[model samples]
Target: MSAPLRLILFDVDGTLVDSQATIFAAMRAAFSAAGLETPTRPALLSGVGLSLPVLMKMLVPEADERTQDQLVTGYKEAYHDLRLTQGAAHSPLYPGARGLLEQLSETPDVLLGVATGKSKRGLDQLIEAHGLERMFVTRQVADHHPSKPHPSMIDTARSEIGASQGDTVMIGDTSFDMQMAEAAGVAGIGVTWGYHPRDALGSAQHMVEDFAQLAGVLNKFWTVDHE
Candidate 1:
């Protein structure tokens, strides 16, 4: 019989790429354009895994839906312009990201995927820039799904890839990701190098400090049935 498939889904912004600076810049510009007080760095980072419209609402709770929509548009415009001018390399992969991906890609029975709050265009640009277009078999973007803490992305990815919940894992930096994984009945792994604090990822089944430690954590899951 064929081995059970393992689907590893990753969050983009905080988990893989360190795009805080770029994101902060765009968010600041967007808020300014919308005539609102710019959110603090911590506030912006805290909202990393949420969709733009949801984030805008959280950042500016008093704003109406139309105003929130305008903020989302402004944020997208500013972010796109920043990428165009600074190039996609502005958001560099975290240390050991490529090595971890390379190792996972070479492992049999492993299939990679992404479930991120980034728009499809944004995710595509990041993937293409880092030559990771071939790494992820499934891509779930904010454009197509509700924000994190919702299981739609994970459910869809699992269904599309024909992977069982027991064999799927969601790796991300936020509580939202962990919550989503829990809601989807999959395992959730947290990385400490991302935006959210370690305490915030309490829902994760495992937490790793760096890429060197990630493989071992994942191996625990991979070898579970065999043991």
Candidate 2:
């Protein structure tokens, strides 16, 4: 008989790739182009798992809808321009991310997916740049679903992969990811080497200090049957 199918969904920004520099730069550029003051680094990083529009609004709630829209467009353009000029080399994956992903991908019962706030275009670019095109079976992005903490992305990924909630896990570095996993009725594993602090990931079912720990944790998570 075939092994039980397991779905592992990942969050892009703070989870897999450390894109803080690029994200902050784009946020600064967007705020500048909109003639608004830039938020501090911590403030910017705090919204890492949220969609661009939602993040912009959170950063500048006093701004009107038109201004929010302008900020969104500006952020996208700035981010795209940065990607073109600097390439994906600027957004490096955390230590052991590639190796762990490769190991998981080779596991017959494991199916990897991405549930991220990144747009499909951005996700595609990053995946291609990192030669990770074959890593994920399903790619859920902000353009197609509600932002993190809503469970829509995880829900969609599970559906596409035909994995039950108990057989699925969401790995990320933010409370948004943990909340989304809970909302989807799946397990959440939080990584501490990302943008959010360990305390922020209280909603996570398990927390790992680094990718090495994450790998071991995932091994157990997959091997053990979960209710």
Candidate 3:
């Protein structure tokens, strides 16, 4: 709580937004097209942070890399063409989401940014629509860098924000996010409003239930100096 966090990287889908219905619809459609059984939303939701390749593996056990690539491509196409719009048609921003981002933005020393697994195009669309583009200094997404459980995105976020690992915190709804933050040497802040639960955020220094607590935790973890 006394680390003086300077940069806070937030995951989009689960942490900041709730696109579960849309994501499930997309995954259901994707799996159906792939000749696989569509999983229940609860099953697919928990695996949200994994890369497409990994997703394909889960969906189709015998899937090879080439097939995985094709399946992922198909999934993205489907998601882009149909599900994303349907999902964002009615947003799922958790309580106090806007207030917290607004607060973070108002704090000049705070370098607000998006570190998500969504593609840059997808991230841009959501951020622009939500009026968050201006609030965020940078948006690091999937395909632009390696996936979670690898620290590339988190590392890139820190570098883009000119932040030291000691001054950074990665907040997300997935265990992979925790792993990524741990690998990047940053505090992993887990949110219960996201995909995974408290038990999954094993490496997280703190797990918060909502944005009210999120703000307080950030204050405790970060010093006003911005490190």
Candidate 4:
């Protein structure tokens, strides 16, 4: 018999929400203030599905830990401050984020949680304002566990959903997500709607071009282990 899916861990920024413009704007501001090269929009995107510290270390590598700290502090403060009012304003949910969440919620056997690179505070605030808190059983953010490409966060979310490694799936838009799922020995699906382009999701087992395709894909993928 195939393993059954009991949990689905999703990435926050790129997968469920469209915060690219806000992220890019805040990143540019922080980089400029730190006297680092302001990343282009595309370059900024490379950070979306990854960890904050990882992104900071890559973009502002010339900085020492203290400088990196300042940049992070600045970035978070700016993003949080500006984003509170703009919550999903500058960034909207991808086409079917709400519908997908609702559909998944209706499944008594399926549990949902967010495994994202966002800070816990950031996730809480954003989810609350965006009306997404009810859809997830748990919210695992960047610093809450080791960042992506690491399975700790995924593992943690699975635990929250009462799912074992054999019965959970990871959904994201980047190689980091795919790598994490692969490392955890679970299935991973990469979505094209997120920051990483389709080509960037090299390690994913499945890929979808839009939100509408998600439900059908998931319904099928969810049962792959059951057969």
Candidate 5:
């Protein structure tokens, strides 16, 4: 008999690509364009996994909805322009990222998916740039979901992949990803190389320091018999 299906969901920014430089630059440009004070690096980095609108609100809590919308629009434009100028190489994958994905893709009964705060266009650009268009089976982006820490993205991915919560795992760099996994009743695995600090990822069932250690951590989950 075939092995039970295993759904592995990934988060994009801090989890996959180290887009810190690109993100920070674009955020500064956005605030400058909007005639507002640029947020500190720490403040900006802290909000990495949230949707644009929600992120703007966190950065400038006193701003009205209209101002927040304007900031979000400005940020998107700046980020897109920067991406065009720098190309995909500007955002490098963390060490062992591609190899880990390749290994997971080759595993039997394993399916890969992405649940990211990035927009669909952004996600597609990153995937295509890295020649990973065929890797992920399902792509869930912030364009459709409410935001991170919400279970909607994970729930949708699980449903589309037809994998029970017990057979799925969420791997990411932030507490938002861990919380989302918990809400979906799936295993949450945190990576230390991402944006959020290790202490913030307390919700994760397992935490690995690097991508090389991820396979072993995940193997424990995949080998379990949920039936």
Candidate 6:
């Protein structure tokens, strides 16, 4: 009999790609264009998994909806300019990320998906630039779903990929990801080499310090021990 299919969903920023520098630069440009103060790195990183408007609101709670809208527009413009100028350097994959994805793709029963706060355009750009258009089976973006911790993205990805909650795993680097996984009744695996601190991922079913550990954890998850 064929092995059951399993779904592995990944977050883009702060999880697969180290886009903090670009994200910070874009935020700074956005705030500056809106004549607002730029938030600190830690403050901004804390909201990495949220949608742009939600992130702007959290970062500048005092700002009105109009200001938040302006900031969002400015951020999109600035990030687009940066991507055009820097190309793939705007968002490089984390160390060992590609290798592990390739390994995972080779597994016949494991299907890969993306559940990220990035817009569909942004996600497509990243995937195309990095030659990852063929990597993911289901691409869930902020364009069609609510923000992180809502479980909407995961629920959709699982449904589209035909995977049960018990056979799905969400891998990310933030509490939002873990919370989303819990909300969706899927396993959450936290990676330490990202923006969020390790302690913030308490809800994760497993934690890995690096992609090497991630591979091992994934193996253990799918491998049933027959004692």
Best by lDDT: 6
lDDT of each: 0.92, 0.90, 0.80, 0.82, 0.91, 0.93
Per-candidate TM vs. native?
A: 0.97, 0.97, 0.90, 0.93, 0.97, 0.98
In candidate 4, position 135 carries an lDDT of 89
Instruction: Name the 10 consecutive residues with the lowest summed lDDT in model 3.
Output: 83-92
What ranges in model 1 sit over 4 Å off? none
Tens digit of per-residue lDDT, candidate 1, span 1-227? 98988899999998999999999999889989888989899999999999998899898899999989999999999999888887867699999999999899889999999999999999998898888988999999999998889999999999999999988999999999999999999999999999999999999989999988988888877777436
lDDT of 6 by residue, 99-216 (tens): 9999999989899999999999999999999998889999999999988999999999988878988899999999999999999999999999998999999999899998999999
Q: Provide the lDDT at 195 for model 5.
A: 91
Taking the tens digit of each residue's C-alpha lDDT, what string does model 2 give over 1-227? Answer: 87668999999998899999999899889999989999999999999999988998898999999999999999999999988888877588888899999999998889999999999999999999899999999999999988889989988888888899988999999989999999999999998988988999998999998888888888887666452
Q: Model 6 TM-score?
A: 0.98
Q: What would the per-residue lDDT of candidate 4 be over residues 1-227, giving only the tens digit for each residue?
A: 64344888898788888888888888877877888778788777887766777888877677799878878877888798778767658567888889989989888778888888888888888887878878888788887777788898887777666687767888998888989999988889999888888897888988998888878888887556456
Separately for all candidates shown, the number of backbone clashes (residues 3 or more apart, or on different chains) is 0, 0, 0, 3, 0, 0
- TM-score of candidate 2 relative to the true fold: 0.97
Residue 211 of model 5, lDDT score: 85
Please provide, for model 3 over 75-168, each residue's C-alpha lDDT reduced to its tens digit, 9 standing for 90 to 100. Answer: 7787787634554553467779999999998885678877777887777777766777678887888877777778998888887777888788
Per-model RMSD to reference: 1.0, 1.1, 3.2, 2.2, 1.2, 1.3
For model 1, state the Cα shift of residue 129 in Å.
1.0
Badly placed stretches (over 4 Å) of model 2 are 225-227
* Residue 201 error, candidate 2, Å: 0.6
Ranking, lDDT, top scorer first: 6, 1, 5, 2, 4, 3
